[model samples]
Target: MLGDMTASTTPATSARLRTEIPGPASRALQERRAATVAAGVSSVLPVYVTSASGGLLTDADGNTLIDLGSGIAVTNVGHAAPAVVDRVREQAERFAHTCFMVTPYEGYVAVCEALAELTPGDFAKRSALFNSGAEAVENAVKIARVATGRQAVVVFDHAYHGRTNLTMALTARSVPYKHGFGPFAPEVYRVPGSYPYRDGLTGEQAAAAALDRVDKQVGGDSVAAVVIEPIQGEGGFVEPAPGFLPALSRWCSEQGAVFVADEVQTGFCRTGDWFASEHEDVVPDLVATAKGIAGGLPLAAVTGRADLLDAVPPGGLGGTYGGNPIACAAALGAIETLRTRDLAAAARRIGETALPRLRALADETGIIGDVRGRGAMLAAEFVRPGTDEPDPDVTRRVAAACHQAGVVVLTCGTHGNVVRLLPPLVLPDDLLDEGLSVLDRAVRAEAGR
Candidate 1:
């Protein structure tokens, strides 16, 4: 187990900087990486991690950085969690892989059962595992199309599904994710989504506006699926207005279209609930989950109404490494941790501790245009004082400063002006407070500039 591991390898909980941000060792690795790795593949912080535990990441230079990003919301139970590590080690000792499709396995079926029990919706549900969020999303689209026999798929503004061809086309952002990657999948449409900060429209009003647009443009009957992130992830932690999700779900049911909640980033108790869609009491016809699932192992799933998934022909949906034994074991252990630790409540506690501090920072620094999110999934949108215009320059400077000061922070948004915080659920209150202090100082310094 993680706790039983040697203490010497795991750095102390607090941030400890022994040298500059990207010290000599990290710089050398960066140079080696630059020579081989693709230029397009970038990192938030260039400090190569040597080890991590709880909420701290130790770099090659021996600097222990406070981890607020949680590897982009993947390590919700925290890095090197005891349960997950132990399970993976035990599974590896038993056997690695025989390919689930070829020989089959109990772990895969067990994970599916767990997912069916945990995911929202009271009706009979089934799941198909995949290797990543993008794969799961693409499969969801396939299932919806097969189930509905329709061609058009509708996504929302400021939404991020994934980077695969179909998902990239479904995505709204064009600069980095979608640029130079087209001739993307056809029949994917984009519609207006509620942005409470920018539009100031109530949930009903936003839903009405979006539905009206769909009626005029694609006609709801033609759309097979309507995919959205309950709380947008890469597009920033943009939580839609309160009634928007339920309204959309109702519209989909009325039109015979599948409502897909892309909870890849907001699932698995990251948003103080098993799923963010539950916050609005909206039960989706389909759901895509990854990131926080499987305790940092490569695993994703498309779980939803049994009818929709069952419509797919046998052997139509599967992959060799979809639910590898080790990954399945990790997921079981991670789920156990989530239940025993009550990490959903832990997420709520994180929000209670961080949101007030962030709101206060927004009050103190006029440049912070908006502070919004739920649970540990939170963000502060930076903008020009007294105006809604995004300030990406300030966002970049603040994130860079936080990195130098030994705090791992991530910036996102279609315009790149939002600083998102996704700290691990296992983060101690003291460590969380310290990370927030660094963020507050960084934002203050940037605001002054």
Candidate 2:
């Protein structure tokens, strides 16, 4: 479906740069945006995108850039996917919003059913939809607190939940996401997360350290929820050590704390699994999902064990635009596309193609301190040569080089030294390889410098 529709708008085979990275048209538009757009909302690339399809984003100056960052892993099915577009159009024509709380709709129930079925749990499950990942996470916290009758919320270092006041307290980073926005929600505790590259500890060891900290600092019984990203997104795409998640889950179960998986970025098919928690065979008590769920639409959900979710009384959990009809329709189509296309397998294939290249690049370039991730959601942590110190400057240079070469990549991590690549699952191998080649050159050039 995407192949047919995107053929006309984007390049059929390769990236085409008619002008510079941010050509004249894009620069002019940026100037206009500076006058009206909020200063806090920043964009990675200077180019103004006119249209995007498949893996290519065409800017105002008509430069087609190969997308290695899928709108922060939002367009896993590809931008303007036919399945999503068609369903959106059909639903919008029928009706857009009726406020699910006021008037229930079939689409919302259908999405909830889909979540119950698809999410990683064999037991009876329930779900509540929200407008964004932040809302989903906030609601998840609410459910956990109410269900457990506890006050403390446990999160980890190098973690990112969302931008809400509660989530900001949950988030580890403070500069941009949490800076100057205090006094945040109370009863939030931060613990150590497994970072294999930096810590070099085995999964069990990492888990023990984290659990020990929680027991001493927060007290295990007081924690309502222990929220974590199966594969951390903003905190540098850090995939916890193999046994770390399971260990934490077991601890949570023992302590009567809800094991919450913030799969907002790692959910859907981004991490080569329906949910990244599945990779470790860990079934969380609650899962916060968004980003890729609705094929780029603004939709999020808190799906989990029915008991925990049902703990909330009627009218206790809902929002006006939580499950808007159009977004629900888009989610249904997107879920269908994922199932029919087996995009999870596609994500695995992407990792098969990307991980090797990235690892090889890490070996070749001393600047790359580590290469780690699952499936298409991969990242390379840049570091100073001969030392493990993060090198954000070099990371910026490498990303800038790739952007100039007509390949779109992104940088992340707490230290701002990780370059992440989130290519669409439908991205052709040739296009992917081409983008990787550009990345290779960029890293190589930066290493030489």
Candidate 3:
């Protein structure tokens, strides 16, 4: 139920289904979308959700589909959690958008304080807010350039930063994100990421190899910052080798280059930790976070070493709606929820249970090329047997079956052949198990085993 009597008003979380997946209502909505929305705004699954709870999404057709994708990992706390809803409603009532820069608010400072404290590295830190993950990343790069007084910005191959022009340049995939966009910003460079599954290079070897590219391609002295995702999100949920991050951090120190960790998809307890960099000994000089920061609200931030963050002149970094009061309030509530309810530990517990089941399924189905990720930020990459070629056909069929069976799933990877599982930590065990069962059956059938 909602105060508004029209659209988006239903039970906050209960999935009440009266028809099949795209039943009459959803089919109509999709038709409207096709007519009015740009074809470029495609979907992984043709679904229309009416409401969602801990682990279920009620479709427009009134069917309860297990939510294993978490809205592409945005609602890590689950949909419409009481804490977040309360904060959002209160803020919306009092003042939805006063703009942080124009009118200072406690909620903004409180969230910044949380970022300063929760992020890795004990050095004094400060934060700047943004409206999206890409905005945060853009701000981080600007800060690095200003802080180090260098021009070259180095990224890795198979990385996914965003859809904006600059980030499109930062991004590697060409089809969807960068397809009709061109004339990208210059001085951005790409090097190899420590991808053990494909590269088969050790941590030190990988670091050296990438640095060699820097010397030949970008030149370390000319580089302002080296940006990376702790767990390569869109490129494939690839975890770097054990010593990869630490080695790179040391190199950044030696070369006087800023190390920026784009934890946009892996932060805020999504990966069983406040920050994925904490898993390794590496502490990034700057960190960018967004997706799950404000419990589904569009709030993002760049927290970094105080001195580096301070290098920019006043007004060098900020957005009009960067720290909207409502988003800040939601962030405060989200952080509080994580602490009071122990969601990070919950993520670890869920991963501990899920990784085994997924690995077992992978063993049973050779189509599963790899299963890698930390905590609930997990993925299973699909490949044709006897070779490492991506099996996009099988991947699509598996996802289609999961949707037909009343479970929401998502696909990723450079090749669009990875099935990423982003179930909320607050999901009930029964619901979680049900989704996995569906996934198992789908995988078995797709693999034809």
Candidate 4:
């Protein structure tokens, strides 16, 4: 029979490397995964995780590693948060799924209500739940097209929407996400977005250039939606310069196109705000949210202007398990944790603590080209010293060293030379500092090499 698992399985707060990162147990699991799992599915680290709590992930080989990526910004409130777990257990005991489309439930409605309240824009708002961020983005696009009666959609450069067919078309990267997955959806256009680090253009300048392209190529009037990430995620933690997002939003408003903010990675207190749009006081016509929503449960939502969402027919905008009851319960718990714990402030604190350290590291090592991002969603871009040329080799080496030392870091960017950090907001200060120290050592070692 099962005994008390918590006492035996709970990992310590600090990182403890029991063996080499992908120790014998993890290597064995990797062999099994190679046999069974598809090659397409990839993992950042070879260390197979058995359990995770707070800011630590316990691997199969009895190693506890500092969780800097937060499962790619999905665990803002931390892993296995008590409130979320309790709520999930309660909801599961009562009812796991009724298929909201078949028989509607209160949890779904409650989550919608929460989204409407939390998402930016003071006007009357509504939401539709989905299983993933890509689905939410797709639904938002559908709503935009239906409302505006237009076919063309505009996405910015360096955007990373998702992996689905339509989202793959929306995405800008060509190597992995969109390489073999071609013959993409039609009516999607890409324009220049403000990359202050690389372009050296002010936000307004970048917006004007992008708008010029839209007018010349896509025709602003024919555009149904102007979709963008307030802060790009997989394309790098590339936050647009000041005034860029606001200008694009204004242009969309003038052109009769819905401005959609894809906040899949930046929402839910990850960026020191309810949504990244709030940072610029830019209210989007529609917002796509997921990742940190629901404390790691599969929940994504499109929340925005009520009129646009309601324009669709009654039968539109729903899926079989869009808002599973258990997921909804967990979302409620996660939302409560955000509000009561003031995790938004926690995110800000993380920024305050880490940004200065990262900047100092950049100063010490010229290879660290740029350090940017808000709140806990921070990144360090790597380039060859004394030149703008990207050095992905240095980035990979640093990440590998950090991994060996028990800090789980992630690399991203269009050029693949950026190391991004997304530590959970709930992490203790000492553990966060420890993780930073490991990162610092890794970067220093790479620079020396």
Per-candidate TM-scores read 0.97, 0.97, 0.95, 0.97
lDDT of 2 by residue, 1-449 (tens): 11122335535467777776788999999999999999999999989888889898888887788999988998999888899999999999999999999988899999999999999989999999999999999999999999999999989999999999999999999999988989999999998999999999999999999999999998998999999999999999998888999999999999999999999999999989999999989999999999899998999999999999999999999988999999999999899989999999999999998898899989987889999999899999999989999999999999999998889999999999999999998898889989998899988888787
Candidate 1, residues 1-449, lDDT tens digits: the string is: 11122335554868888778888999999999999999999988899999999899988978888999999999999999999999999999999999998998899999999999999988999999999999999999999999999999999999898999999999999999999989999998898999999999999999999999998999988989999999999997899999999999999999999999999999999999999999978999999998899989999999999999999999999999999999999999999999999999999999999999999999999999999999999999999999999999999999998898888999999999999999999999989988899899998997787
lDDT of 4 by residue, 1-449 (tens): 01112333444768887677788999999999999999999988999898999999988977888999999999999999999999999999999898998998999999999998898878999999999999999999999999999999999888999989999999999989999878999999999999999999999999999999999998989999999999999888998999999999999989999999999999999999989999989999999998899999999999999999999999898988899899999999999999999999999999999999999999998889999999999999999999889899999999998888889999999999999999999999999999999999899888887
Instruction: Work out candidate 2's RMSD over C-alphas.
Output: 2.9
What digit string (tens of lDDT, one per residue) describes model 3 on residues 1-449? Answer: 21122334445342334555567888889999999999878876676877777777776766667788887788888888889999999989998777777778888999999999899989999999999999999889999999889989989988999988888889989988998889898999988988888889998899888889898987778989999998999998989888888888888898899999999999999999988999986799999999889988999999999999899998788888999999998898888888888889988988998899999998987989889988889899999987789988888889888887777888888999999999887987777777888899999997785
Runs in model 3 with CA error above 4 Å?
A: 1-18
**Candidate number that wins on TM-score, 3 or 4:** 4
Query: Model 1: which ten-residue window has the lowest total lDDT?
Result: 1-10
Candidate 4, residue 2: how far the Cα is off, in Å: 32
Q: Model 1, which residues run further than 4 Å from truth?
A: 1-10
- Global fold similarity of model 4 (TM-score): 0.97
**In lDDT terms, which candidate is top?**
1
Q: Which pairs clash in model 3? A: 1-10, 17-62, 17-63, 18-62
Off by over 4 Å in 4: 1-11
TM-score of 3: 0.95
- For every candidate in turn, the CA RMSD to the true structure comes to 3.0, 2.9, 3.8, 3.3
